[model samples]
Target: MQDPRMEDELVIASSPTDDGISCWDLHTGAEHLRYKLCSSPPHGLASVAGRFLASSQLRNPKSSASGTILYWSWNKPQPEVKSFPAEAIKPLVSNSQGTYLAGGGVSGDIYFWEVATGKLLKKWHAHYRAITCLVFNDDQSLLISGAEDGCVRVWSLFLIFDEVRRAEAKHLFEYSFNEHSLRVTDVKTGYGGCNAIIVSASEDRTCKVWSLSRGNLLKNIVFPSIIDAISLDPGEHVFYAGGRDGKIYIAGLSAPGASNSSYGNHIIGSMSEHSKAITCLASSADGFLLVSGSEDGMIRVWDTRTRNITRIFRHTKGPINNVLVIRQLQNTSPRTSNHTLASPLRRHGAPLPSPLEKFVNSADENAYVKVFINPHTTSNQHLDSSYITVQTMENQIKELQQQGSSAAAEVDVERLKSEQQRSLQMIQQWKTMYDNLHQFCVDELLDPSHPGISSGQPM
Candidate 1:
């Protein structure tokens, strides 16, 4: 069996003017599958758990037409599904588990959908202006969004779904940082969940790092030019900001170093090779490789440690706007002998999810209520487990009992009981193991054969 880690890494890039999405093998620089008929805007491309590719189409600014989102399976070059959203979507993001997808609309509204059912779970006015970027935190519990209004907001998914909490809270968002003076460009979250740092770039020629736990700005870095995209290093030591001046600036995070660079404080260094402005940036899993897409219609893979260009892929049709680094699909592997071929009779890989709803349906209120009663009952698999606790489950059971029991509610209560029992069993098992270890240590110390005691350590 082939190790999944050894699987090939693919770099996918899209352009606003081009009609196709380009894919290339990261290590070998060999071109792979190219999905056709996609004109993706900046931050519009998304990969759904590597099962398929999706991109929000760029519409003409003069046209009043509805926005379109297309999805393509791994083996097909053509889009399998097309969705018409109410307004043009500028940014699209999906959690690591691919269970939920979110899009930022030009109308300043955010649309969130369940990937499994294509149901619009929530739609709320997220910003005063169009949202420019959206990112989920490490645990997928909080969604951090940036808008053209120069504001960055952190939203807790738990509060968003709980109507009772939403009614009582002063604001839907947990934190709002309005430090930038111009349109915000990109936002990236670090590893820690509540304590993680969020880095946001803007046309104000500044990048600000905000603390998720404290809800305050941690570091504000001034750059020479507007930053369109930023990628956080895996180690959280430094982050790379792609500037309109065709340079990728490396800013220190936890690294113990004084900024001596001429650019500004926390500006450690830069990598410059692109002739035109950089449009997008993505860091590899190992933190050593960085992939950048530029307006010069080129994609450059850099070895960050060596500060050298490892490989370059050109997108000759148009300037690259979005870039993503994802693992190669297993079924699409070249070495697989039984690989299924793309056929007109049937699509390849997973079937396309249903089209996203343009508006929230009031008829789905029952479903929303169920989700509020038990967040885990829905298909939102990516929700952090820390949010669900034994006390929370017990309280939910009491509420359900007060509301009168149906078959569904009874089943949920039974499941919660089982979970509580399992947790108690686990605690007992851990305590027994600790007792055995303690007894063993006591026996060893009392034994005359013990080296230190027999030798009279004082002597």
Candidate 2:
């Protein structure tokens, strides 16, 4: 029997030069479906829970039109849905649950939308210059962004949704790291929730690791060339940096022996296979394999342990910029002899989400509502239901208080009081019924009129 893990490994790669998006099997190097008419910028391609593929289009240098976002179904060659943003969006990211999608505009603003409703939920200034990269933390509660201003900021989604808390806080960002001198190219988060470490690469030819818990830089390693992308190892022992000099530099994390390496401190080694600048890097589910895309229009899968190229895929039309390793979708693959075409609705099962809005609706300023649901799964997933309810109600109450709407608060209090009274009345009714039943039984037993009791059968 073949291993499911090996069969499910897939590699998706795209370029900025109108080469569309190319996908291939990670193990066998066989090509899958090729999506067309997509010219994506760096950090623009995303897979929404393997349901569909989305990419932010690269705007023409002289075009004054709004930014375009395209979505393609797995079985379709062309994009099925399109969205126009207020500005040219460069980088896009989605949460793990696929409930929200975030994009960074060229105007240095971040636009957030609810995926299901396609409503623009939040828009705020995130950077001084064009935003470059955006990534979510391990738990999806926080978002980290990097930009041309050489700044990286962490944002809490909970606070972003709570208007009252946002107004009360001194700053919107939870933590801001302004250590990089040049434009930040990429940012990645480690495994821990609050204690996770962040690795950010920059055009200044350096990579800095920051500790989230301490909100400080932990290690900084200067590279031989500017790093455009980075991939953290699954085990958190090391991370790979893709440099403009066409080399994948391996830097140590928790592992030792970095001080003795010839490349420099904390620099363990390097992998050289691409002929041109390395554009992006991604690691496999297991830490043994590393995949890299390059300006030479080639994708190479390297055996990290042996430092040898295991497989190579060529994207001949343009320079490969974005690469992702995801689970293979059955319907996305080529049709076999027994396969038949499915209807559009049947292919996705659910209707496509509406087009994302360009701006927030001013008329309905208080229309935003957030609901958190716990998915029913077989795995051990623990959630504090009461705590979540309390937190949500507290935020709503705070917002009401800030609005100076005492009438709304009083109405809610009265409604809750009425509910409490009804509950107490129902409890009293149950107690009265129990007492009446007890008295009837006692009377029947003493009067010896009940057939079942047998008038003191013990005597």
Candidate 3:
């Protein structure tokens, strides 16, 4: 993908296909080596901060103690701590900045952990079935989770913590929906926390939105593909749902009491280029950039605005079941109260774009200016070096992809060379015309019938 990481390096995931986790670094499209986990059946994987990682796994349902959760340092080989009885086969996801992690169990319970302390801060019976998906808001006060029972729940962290601390916390809200045929596929909270809308994907081949405050199902969007995961732009305005069709779609949402977003509220763009399913998605604060990881072991970064691909999608060579974006030192100015801490985020999703580009940052909840440096560095030397590396690698990829294409559509080096020649010929013709026009404009006439007709089209 055309991401900064492709230059720095891509993250490659290689599990045993049953258990264990591995991270491979991409130097020139090939992995240098790997970071391995000793554990088996490691399903969920998430990047916490710049220094931490989190994961989880679900075992045979018939077994009582089959599910487990794990947390570790960025490059460390051992698990910091492992908890059992989690319900799903997916990895655990941390809060906005990876300081906190949340996972669901087969017992219909949700467990919360603080990464640094490895403390089981809270555990609650969240649903009646398997907790299939979960996500936290930017400020960590709100959480949205979905389950196999066709129920989506909104939780108030302030209340959960208050109840744990034995202090008085404001009353919280929760909402449930029974609108899908299969289990809840995935769930995500507001990216920038600019909105309170909770979005979820389901096996029913559709996505639904709920009001985190009132606990109401606001809209439902059906997709032609089975939505394996769903994500939102940082502005919360654009919602991206990805599925089996190997495409990610962008939709708008209606506020508290509007009609459908696609038909009534405010819904817009989408994208579908991957040949496989997209398991993970990440975006920057302004929602201008998006990074998506797929089952094909590719991670592509997109310019959501132009809807044109800008980068590579190879962070790994294995099925990347999960991905998260990490941020540090948030710079936000809050609107609610004082004492607002800037918490960075590891984004879970992104889609297409529109003209009225709005950002949905979870930090909007706390009002913090994200103090981040622009990632792009304009270096002529680096640019040349990067282009040369990319050209060589792309030649290899072209060979592979062409093999999969039909004969008429096949593209080989010879074809590229021929196309280059054609392009040069066109450039030469354009230069000749430009020269003729300039000479004609000053030299008066070239033909008997043609005077100073430089301000014109070709005869």
**What's every prediction's RMSD, in angstroms?**
8.3, 16.1, 22.5
On TM-score, the candidate that comes out on top is 1
Ranking by lDDT: 2, 1, 3
Q: What are the runs in model 1 whose C-alpha is more than 4 Å off?
A: 1-5, 63-65, 329-334, 337-348, 364-459
Model 2, runs deviating above 4 Å:
5-7, 62-65, 255-258, 329-350, 371-459
Clashes of each: 0, 0, 43
For model 2, residues 108-222, the per-residue Cα lDDT tens digits are 8999987766778789998989899999887778889999999999998888878799999999999999999999999999987768999999999999999999999999999
List the lowest-lDDT window of 10 residues for candidate 3: 348-357
- Candidate 3's residue-wise lDDT over 1-459, tens digit each? 225332232343433244244443222233322345533232266665434455664445466466565555443456655555324434356554434667666667777754443445567777888677776666566667777797777776655655444354332434556777788878777633424677788888778877665667778777767887766877767777776778777776644434343433333546868888876676655667666667786667678888877667454345666554433222221112122211111221111111110112254442322111112222322111221222344556667776775543444566788779879998999999999999986565565456335546565
lDDT of 1 by residue, 1-459 (tens): 335456567889998985589887777666766789888878999997666788888667445255798888777789988888888888999877666789998878999977666667789999998898999887788888999899999999899988889999999999999999999999999886888899999999999989887989888888999999999999988999999999999999974446779887889899999999999999887888999999999999999999899899988669999999986544444443222223211333345678877777686553332332222222322223323334355677777778787854876878899889879998999999999999999999888989988998842
Model 3, CA-based lDDT: 0.56
Clashing pairs in 2: none
Relative to the true structure, candidate 3 has a C-alpha RMSD (angstroms) of 22.5
What is the lDDT of every predicted structure here?
Answer: 0.82, 0.82, 0.56
